[model samples]
Target chain A: MPSTEYRPPRPFSRIYVEDAARDHPETARVLRRFSRSRTVPISHYKDIFNRPRQEWRAQKESPALILAARHGEFLYDASAYTPTFGHKRFHYNALALNCVYDCAYCYLQGMFPSAHIVLFVNIEDYFAATEAALAEGPLYLALSYDTDLPALEHIIPYTRRWIEFTRTRPGLTVEIRTKSASFNRFADITPTDNAVLAWTLSPASVAARYEAKTPPPAQRLRAAAKALEAGWRVRLCIDPVLRVPGWENAYTALVDEIAEALDAGKLEDVSLGVFRINRDYLKHMKRRAAPTDVLYHPYEKRSALATYTAEEHKSMTSLLRSCFARHIPADRIHIV
Target chain B: MIILHTALAAEARPLIRRLGLKPGPGAPAPRLMVGDGTALVVSGTGRVRAAAAVAAAWTRLDATGHAPSAILNTGLCGAADSGRHPRGSVFVINACTDTTCGRRYYPDILLRHSLPEAGLHTFDKVIHSPEEARSGVRTAPELVDMEAAGVFEAGTLFLPASHVHALKIVGDALTDARFVTAADVESLIDDAIESITAFAAALRAFAASSEKSGRVLDESEERALGEAMDALRLTATQRARLSAAARHYRLLHDAPPSPVLAAFAARPPKSKNERAQALDRLLHALNGV
Candidate 1:
């Protein structure tokens, strides 16, 4: 086995600022926060973020910050991979492109060409669009679709800002899903009834092996317990459950831990999913990312999707649902 | 592979000597020096010359099937504030701009280095005084050069922006017009040689690691798989499917799936139907049936 040496996470040594976004308040805030970092100016974020031949692994090693004012589309219909939680009008936004945490199974590695975080500084435009979409009917918005907003709260309090935005909008329900234990970022603010603080919890073994730089399951559960105590609508996500060697035991232990740590009766719901990705994205990921067992699995290809065979998917999901059902009611378990 | 471009022979001499580079066969235009997995090109002092030399050197190396993984363009530069950025001080450029077109290129500096970071402006004409530097360069760059933009533009044509870099050693303050000699330029680069080589080594290692990670099959496994396809006389579609299956199997098992092809050695498939049936069995075996 290769020797495991601990290396600290790379710093965001450079911040690319768009010419038009230089005067934005959020831009100024980020610049002030990372004052010691080098600031490079560009006309658009795509110049750096969407460049071809960018080494995805290298950029992930030391991701830079690209702050640009978004001029075009802000909201998109949630992709098939995301579960809408039975919401009829579901939408997502790219307030930030790319994520800080580098999970091996993340589809962002294939969806995006670079790992540099491109933060849309013109957040008010996204709010305006969301409000416009809300005018049509009730909207279930996934705020952290492309990124983990809570993980980046220290850099820019986008999670807090989104929670604040959702407080007044009665017909809009937003889900800020994360693998972060950063509930303390917005601890002082009152929890909004419409905003859901969803945490994706994985087995400790899985977390340590596959999820790089993400908080462990115990820390996430502690954060969820704090949210539940503060009357926040906290949801537990056991999502993209990999079919590792001992997945059954790992997930059962995870469910038991979740039950012991927090009151499942007061929990909002449990989201369960098998590991599935776009077929093309999986190809791109295999071509770019390091060799890992998860990407090497012989998945069943159906059209543009790559996932486990139907029998395998059913077996994995059934095992988890059975394990989780003992703590949470069967009605509250959602599988996507 | 690593490729280093310098604007003058004086700038390249110290590096060639320090890195133990030898001259290429016969003579090449714009002077090419070679070492283990590294080559240096001494282009004359100008943007056009620098860009052309990089392209020519890259083409020659690529033709030999040893394309560079990283390109470093290092040479002497001028900084207006000499006290803050004194002569002989080196900097890793974070961004470079072309004053002629007002176009800027930002090289992703992902590696860790102790040298100070600075933005560079590539000018068409030399800056004789600080007044000209202030008027012409709008980005307030700390270092001024003549080939950074050209080098970046050419290097990025073949490699990613992350793999392209520019290191500048301050040769003088912006006040001097023609005072610095070739010896002075050589000394400046020689002083910062360690940092330059260290950065280059880091880039090469990073690229090598990435290449290793992205590789689905080793050379021997690839050869074995290729020979199996020829033996099977598979169609184009079948060849593609078999190749994908072999890669998937190798990724899972850490060994090539070509050994399974030995079953057909005694009685090779004779018809299209037989080949299809054999391929299905082979794929099923590779997929862990």
Candidate 2:
């Protein structure tokens, strides 16, 4: 039976402000939105966030907010586990730390000690750093590495800023991946070929079981369809395919649903991969999310990456690739 | 169990009466009170007494084989300014610094509470003059207490920092020190008992939820596994992986003594390499590696 208990939105009750960012215009703008929340000042963001003995599980129940001025390097080369999608200069930026949506399989659970969202209210700094990096060579920057930026469009318009910033710079390709269904934010703006709005699609069964508080798969497909209709380069990410019970039927139906809902011809690309996580991160996740089936998989560790055994990986990947081949051209499908 | 520490009898009197606690028999040196799943200790003033009282209370609770789930220090404090927060206003101490030792401690504010939070300065001597309170304000502490830092430091020795909490009621502002009487101290704490009770209940709920979420193995099981793995002469990495694999198996199947693990445990490996090989084989069998 479905639960009918009413749950109020768990918005942040406190916003920790870094001393340097207290006077920043972006800080003022963000604070204006959450004027009711209590403001606490700190010398650095880490003082509150990186403190020892933090209850990651309890904090995740209702995460607080933190605003800070990001110092030093803003971009980093993509991790070996992350696929570059054939881009030679593939890099990622963390304008924010941690994500808004809580997926049981998300690596952020292991990567961060605290679940509170930290938004570096210094977009100009990140842009300046990106411009400097781009001056040397062509850049393929994934702007939503640590966060689902588009999901926070109502709070911060970094996605819109990235779209506007990419328009002026040549040889700059940006990918903003999200599971958020808020695609109307891009309706008024003209789509740029250099920008990609990647939507992570999952089987409805898998999403319902693992992806908590995320938009349903059907809504995500509709949003992807809307983005394509807006002339935006839309990519479908079927990565992290979970092997739930009756997964084959679920994924097959998911492919059929995608074919019926979206124009596969207009898709920029389709990326496929099975469930995998950094070995260290899996350790952190196991302690907090022990009841989660997807996280409890006996995974094989290869060079610091924990994934299913070779046979399981091959079986799931091959099955997904064959399913994609039925609708999209094989050449357009990239398996990572 | 929730353990609450206070520096004076006047400070703990209202809570004891409200929570319906009786005089505890154990720990004769520092007066202890017990009721329900909570205990209260009255430590005399000063950092030394506070730290010693916390240690004694923890030892007594440990002797009873019941570790405290949460530790809280609730008492009266001198506020920097009366205009900002008048007497009887309760404040949650988020950070505490010892003026004598110059060391700082931060209590985890993971759980939500009804009282507003502020930083606290723990001075060896009470701040009486307005000039001293103004000087304390320059140090950036909203409230001045005598034992919060000591209580926090000692509580963290036995419990996680996240489970340690410190709450203070403004007994008097520096400007009002001359007019404040002993009756005022008890009355101020008495007035804030409702908020304190709510805070205690919230802490208990948080501790319960934390235990539910932290379903890492029981202490006995973890220790047994560690000893068994040590007997096999496994490397640190191998031990960690095998532990994770065991936890994964237990979570997925909701069953203990996995067949593959049992097989390995029945015939212990003779060498480190053999232990590593056994682990790999077990993980492969369990995880389909």
Candidate 3:
């Protein structure tokens, strides 16, 4: 039998201590998981989490009761910022971090120090914080941008809480996004008009390669179908279209399957984008990724975004927009 | 192609038959490239053996000067939780964990989220309950196979940054002499073959690009990696600590620890039987589980 050896914990960007007043008491609770290991000489760590920047003051920083944060109570700002496309005018909140699935191409590779998940149970506090920050009415919030809130329903049931919280405020609309097939968790919940569910999907081929930790694409679609039937508004996100030899056919097949699963008339929206990362994250990506040319291409610098060249971005986005529009209204489409 | 990790040769004979080939007489030195790109090497279920097995596989590829895009550690992992777990379910691991101690790993391909996450972890011990399995998950390992981490490390020896795609099937969770049954073993093996076969095919089919990068040990790349480490604020002390850790890895790669090798060399195999046994052991260890 092989002996178990210690592998150094991956690098961390920053750490936040859960102050007594914070929203999520659970954030600090999970960080101490290793405290028991301190008794062993080899297991002791200098600091449970890296606290490089408690206050850079240059970077936008906030610390509350982080219920649970991915990658050691650290969240990357500007690592990802999506502009709501179509009828959804909202921003995604990665307040809780890391999904239950460990997909190969997941952006978490560059975002976290460890794979252990951290959820900020004080999510309601984040909602309160969001409400306080938003002077506008009816602002849509993406709940599971960095993690799957619904999948954890079997465990943490955070998404259920979010739904209840959203139901209280008519001005607050939520979009619970997921790639999980754990649809049974929400099979019985009555849908709220203010709550929109966006399912991030990839082609079967993509699932076979990079989506190893994810439920099969069809399973996710089946979940989406159930949600739509339960009277939930659904959006299809095929962003980060990974480049494979036959991406055209693969995406076509994905859309076809999704279209089959959901009555196209009830399909709320669809958004798609080619895979691209900001240049800063490109550094982190290089350190931990597998062999692939899809990510290493020279990106174009546009509006401080490192992505495909103008023509490539425009054409690709336009192509995807049309591909998605073929199944849903163009007004319902959003590019994130 | 299917990957097998059982130590039982008599049972393995049936697998060989399924592949329409006879089991090689008495476990010959684990062959490389026996079935083209799909090679079978014994990765005895543990960390050290798995690492060694991985290294041996790399040595074969290293001699040819070609590296495989994927390295998989296929095996049976036991835990006493059949009531909760369907026997044949397959999982690809995210970390190789030592559940006895809570050591965990973040594989080269880091999952964006935690569930929907499948990874094979090489563990020295077996977990016997849903609670034990949950603890394994809490340790941050998705799948608890025996040897993928070592195999991944061995691949790292050659590529220094190769990623291992590992998977495991549930075998006997806790099979005692009386508790163990051929029916149990066959069920696990069948599930293993199906899952591994699907896993290999899935990798081939799912060609995807996420913005993942591999840093070469080369100077420029090293600087980039170092800068990333710095951005992550690996404290200067931490940097030095990592340096010391890197030193050990370097020593292992370029040179074998002398005293141990000398002892093995001194007692070289004298007969073909001894050689075969020695080679099998070495080959098995090469898998590094």
Which candidate number would show the highest TM-score if scored against the true structure? 1
**Candidate 2 segments whose C-alpha is farther than 4 A from its true place:** A1-9, B23-27, B97-106, B136-139, B216-289
For model 1, name the residue pairs that clash. none
Order of models, best TM-score first: 1, 2, 3
Supply every candidate's count of residue pairs whose N, Cα or C atoms clash at under 3 angstroms: 0, 0, 60
Model 3 lDDT tens row, B122-215: 5566544445556534433334545555565554454312134556565554443235566666656664564455555443222111112232
lDDT of 2 by residue, A255-331 (tens): 88999998887798899888888888887876654257567676667988988779988888888888888888888
Residue-level lDDT tens digits of model 2 in B51-133: 89988988887788867889889988888777786778889887788877667676667776556788888888878755674
Model 1 lDDT per residue over A167-227, tens place: 9999999999999997888789898999999999999999998899898889999999999
Interface DockQ of each model: 0.36, 0.29, 0.04
Q: How many Å off is the CA of B170 in candidate 2? A: 1.1
In candidate 1 chain A, where is summed lDDT lowest over 10 consecutive residues? A1-10
Ranking by DockQ: 1, 2, 3
